[model samples]
Target chain A: MNVAALGAAELRNRLHGDGLVYRVGPYAVRLRSSIDQVLSAFSCLYADYPVEPDDGFADFHVYVHRPQNLRRWYRPQAIFEFDGKVPFKPLPFSQSYPFFEWGLNWCVSNHISNHLIIHSAVLENRGQAVVMPGNPGVGKSTLCAALMLRGWRLLTDELGMLSVDDCLFAPVPRPVSLKNNSIDLIANFAPEAVIGPRCEDTVKGTVAHVRAPADSVARAAEKATPRLVVLPQYVEGANAQLIPLSRPEAAMQIAGNTFNYSRLGLQGFATLTRMIDGCRCFEFRYSRLDDAIDTFEQLLVGGEG
Target chain B: MNSGTHRWSVLPDTVLHWYCADDETLVYYEQAGTTHLLTATSAEALRFLEYNEANIGELVAVVSQTLTLDVDGDDEFFFLMEALVEQLQKLGLIEACAH
Candidate 1:
């Protein structure tokens, strides 16, 4: 059953008690929290995710709790605990949901070694996936959200999980975090997009999350062969264009973006080389989402220029 | 300058992983954990140096013959080969033999 099927009281009970175990893409997460904001965020953002049975093993056990000190009465704060250990400093109590999302991303990127995780947003179109690798505030998430609204299936909004053996991208579809001005930008761009509550202040400025489409969450197990690697730059007022990149240049750029390339050693080199061999690479610069979408659509039909 | 006295050889214990596609070659140096893209001439020079260590003049002569360039008459070709050797040495891919 999906999380939406449960009544509010039951859902709250599950979260406050033994935790609500749910399947999120390739991993099962057990989330425990007494914070009302976190519960509200999960109820809205994760309503479509499947609720796993208690017997199944959870890949991550996470908790959001208020500190017990008198500071709770003065200035309340929320701490994120993973497997009973705190990995981050306490954030303001209002920032619980954003902290949960960031903490979960941290868990997957740091713990999962089987797949080569890259700090990129991945999406699929016509059975072909495009991996968009970029640094923070580069509009990677904004572009990803725009594409998803434009009928592209969201594979992931943060992690580009590439299988080590097959070089296929494993789907880890989750809420797309929109930071600062992009939150309002996406709201205006895709008026129909479902966005959760905004967590103001804290790190990364004000942050909000856009829920992944129900179709993407349903097809979580499906993987896609990466056919293109685009390093995107969202320059203001710049004309939208795709510049073809040499295989060697693309390979080196992808290696630099990968989280575990050095940790995986020679195996990482082999996997990346194989991916670069099959995909057309590009450096995409754009300011307009519509123009970017048109260019990418033409690319799919006509192949790289 | 005695061509027979100088030799060029790849650094010992350095591992290189190569990926060649459509006239482009990428070499990954295992020791440094760095990947580099090579021009056709540079790729050919490295491939030649992998098996045989040759002096600058000898390398220039052999590479000129392999690439079908007449370095004997072309000053640009001669300097290109000289610069290529220096570049490879700076990258730690090859070392000059001590006299």
Candidate 2:
């Protein structure tokens, strides 16, 4: 049964007790939260995600709630608890939903070692996956979301997962986070896109999440073969183009953007380089999403990306 | 500088891993757990020093030959050679020994 089948009241009831255990691709997470905004977010952003059996094993036990003591009465804040340890200080109570998203990302990146997790976005079209590694403000997530709207299957909007043994991308299709101008940009770009509640005055400016497409959520267990590794940049008003990046440089760039490269050591290096060697790498720059989509479309269709 | 007083050689093959693409090379130093991108010249220089501990002059000969540049007192080549050696040594991929 998906979360939507539970209805808001029953979902809220479960969250108040032993928690709602749900699968996020490769891992199962048991989430406990009583905050209203966070509760509503589950219905809006996570409606399509199926609910696992309550007694099933969960990889992470997380909580988002007001602190127990008098601090909760003061400036009303919500703290994230990961298996009873507070990983981060509280944000305003209104930001609980985004905080939950960020905290879950923290849990995945910090705890998992079986995969070479790079801070990237993964999308697939015609069975070929592309991993785009970029720093914040590079608009990789925006590009990823736009592609998904154009019929590409979104593997993830963050945390590109490549297995250490096989280097194949394990899909963890979660909501695409949008911020500032991107919120309006996506709204304008695709009027039919479903966006969640907006959290104002957050650290990353006004932020919201676009729900992952139902098709992507349904096929979360599918792994993808990487064929293109891209370093994306949003250059204002520039023509969208895919510039060829040398294999050595591509390896370095991917290594630099990785979250657990040092922890994985030589195994990580071998995995990253093998993927780079097998794939066609590029440094992609664009201003308009339409042009970007066209450029990617041409690459996929012409077989010369 | 008194760089000529010491001989430099690459670390043993066991401690270093090399990946070549086109004219560029990426080397991973196992001890330092770091990867480095090297130019064709640096690759040639390291290739020469991998077999024999040589001073800067010998390294310049191999690297210049690989680049097909004249080594007849060309200041630019010498400067680039010295800089490349400095970079390789900094990465712990190469070290200087007493001649």
Candidate 3:
């Protein structure tokens, strides 16, 4: 792969004095570091598409080699880089960050969309996709990771691209970001799961990326009409519970949670209405991952009550 | 204050609720807080919201003379006006003027 032939090296830098340049999409981005760092980030996120050259003008190109560079690049509306830092507040250390590169990819991809990009997990069973959209500590990712391990096809462990018009969810299928106890929990719960190295002292405590099941990666582009849009809040020592949500409530919730819902204007509204009409909305509270997975599986097998 | 005072600028003749704000345009719904994206025709009706309390008789005259109504004579035109008005009222964009 001739790197120069693909994209014009836009930005250049040297990491630890290593001459490194990144071909962003179609444009070659020059940076200061080993391409290994960039490749590592790409691997963490599971970006299978080829390094497209001179893809033309991008929204922005940035480089992250130092720890403090994390704070500097935080404001990109849409970000694309790999750095070890925790995005969640009350910064959890002791545990290393898993999949910093994957996390960065998720941010950039989600930001590019003219829809609300949520930090949630999405998975599909049967033909319909179940999207769990919410904040970082919601256990949405854990549940998403577990289900994917248990034969549910993973669409995304972090972002769900939902079109309001057809109400269909396009698959992102990135690596699942598991933190602290989640890393161990999944390892113990499903020994077959592929858990990555942990990066310490960032946000959300110690973090790691769990590689998506191979079947999911193969079918990463599968699109499904969202059968359900759920907001899950996980609590320790509590039983799993699924609460019903009305169409109006769902619409409002999605609108509020959507990253760029208001940005797409009429198109966004139309798409959102279509999504709300097509799917059932719910608010779930669960403590145990297996129980949550079972309840969702049951709903998929039978019509929801 | 007066619901009928201001009609949604984007939605012309049909009923509308100025429900959402977008980057460039505003989202006007045919019903208040409802899910339906106002069809073009319904959006056209939103133009009538610009008028301050125009009655069905006035609207029919305007819609008919200014554009195509697809209806027969004055009676049918009046019926269409009434229906449009009813939808507008449902959307909370217009009210029947005391006059």
Candidate 4:
């Protein structure tokens, strides 16, 4: 059963007691939280994620709760505990859900050694995945959310897990974490999108998450073939253009934006080069959402990208 | 002046893997876990050094002749040669060959 199948009282009861074990991509996460905000956020955003049995092998056993110190009565704060260790400093209690999201990202990005994890956004259509890796403020999440709204299946918004073994793209399909103005942009761009509660004044400014589409969640275990690797540059007022990159340059770009590429050594080098050699790489510059979405659609059907 | 006729050869073939794309030549040094995008001149220089032991002057001559650079008295050519040799040596991708 998925998260949407759980009753509100049952969800709360599970969270407050032993915790709810759920499947997120390949990992099973047992989340224990008495916090109402986290419960509401999970119910709304992770509604489609599959729920695991009560006693399964959970990769990450986590908690989001008050620090249980004097701060509980004061300006309460929430810390994310992963496998018995608090990995990040406490944020204001109001930011609990976002903290949970960030903590889970940390767990997966650091621990998933079997795949070449990258700091990227991935989406797919026509059985071809486009992996977008850019520095912060590159509008990766916004572009990903827009493309996803326009019929492209959202594979992932934060972590782009590429298989180092067989050169396949693993589908994490987690919620798209949109920050600041992008949140409003997504809301206005796709009013049908279900956005979770917005947390204000956190590290990445005001932030919110767009729930993964049901189709993406349902096909969560499917691995995708990366056909196009786009290094997106979101220049304001610039025309949408897809410029081709040489395979070597694309390989360098992938190495630069990766999370565990260097650590994996030559195995990573061979895997990345093989993947880039097969993918049609591009430097995508775009401003308008409509034009960007149109260009990708044309690329999908026309093979122009 | 930095050349000093010191012979250089590329690191072992097992440690270095080359991938040439449309516009770039990239090499990854597995031992150091580093990747480098080489210029045409740098690529030629490395290839020359890979199969044969050559000092900096020999490299400059071979690479300049291969790419047809104005090496007669060009300061840029000299600078490029010195910098390439320095970088390759620093990256541990090239070492002073035993005479």
Supply DockQ values for each candidate.
0.55, 0.73, 0.04, 0.78
Candidate 3 deviant stretches above 4 angstroms:
A1-63, A66-118, A164-166, A303-305, B1-99
Candidate 2 chain A, run of 10 with poorest lDDT: A296-305
Whichever of 1 and 3 has more DockQ, that candidate is: 1
Compute each candidate's TM-score over C-alphas: 0.93, 0.95, 0.61, 0.93
Off by over 4 Å in 1: B1-6, B62-72, B81-87
- List model 3 lDDT by residue over A1-305, tens digit each: 33222332321223224333333221233323333434444344433332323433334343333234454345312222433333433221222123334444545554566444545577888887787877777787788888899999887777667754445666666568788888899999899877666666554567778876656755645677677778888887888888887655566666666666556656666676666666777898888888988889877876443
* Deviation of model 2 at A259, angstroms: 0.9
Error of 1 at A135 (Å): 0.7
Comparing chain B with the reference, what is the TM-score for each candidate? 0.78, 0.82, 0.50, 0.80
Best-first order by TM-score: 2, 4, 1, 3
Once superposed on the true structure, which residue ranges of model 4 sit more than 4 Å away at CA? Answer: A302-305, B11-14, B60-79
Candidate 3 vs. true structure, TM-score? 0.61
**Model 3: how far residue A6 lies from native, Å:** 18
Candidate 1 chain A — worst ten consecutive residues by lDDT sum? Answer: A296-305
Model 3 chain A poorest 10 in a row by lDDT: A88-97
Chain B TM-score, structure 1: 0.78
Distance from true location, Cα of B94 in model 4, Å? 1.7
Instruction: For model 4, state the Cα shift of residue A256 in Å.
Output: 1.6
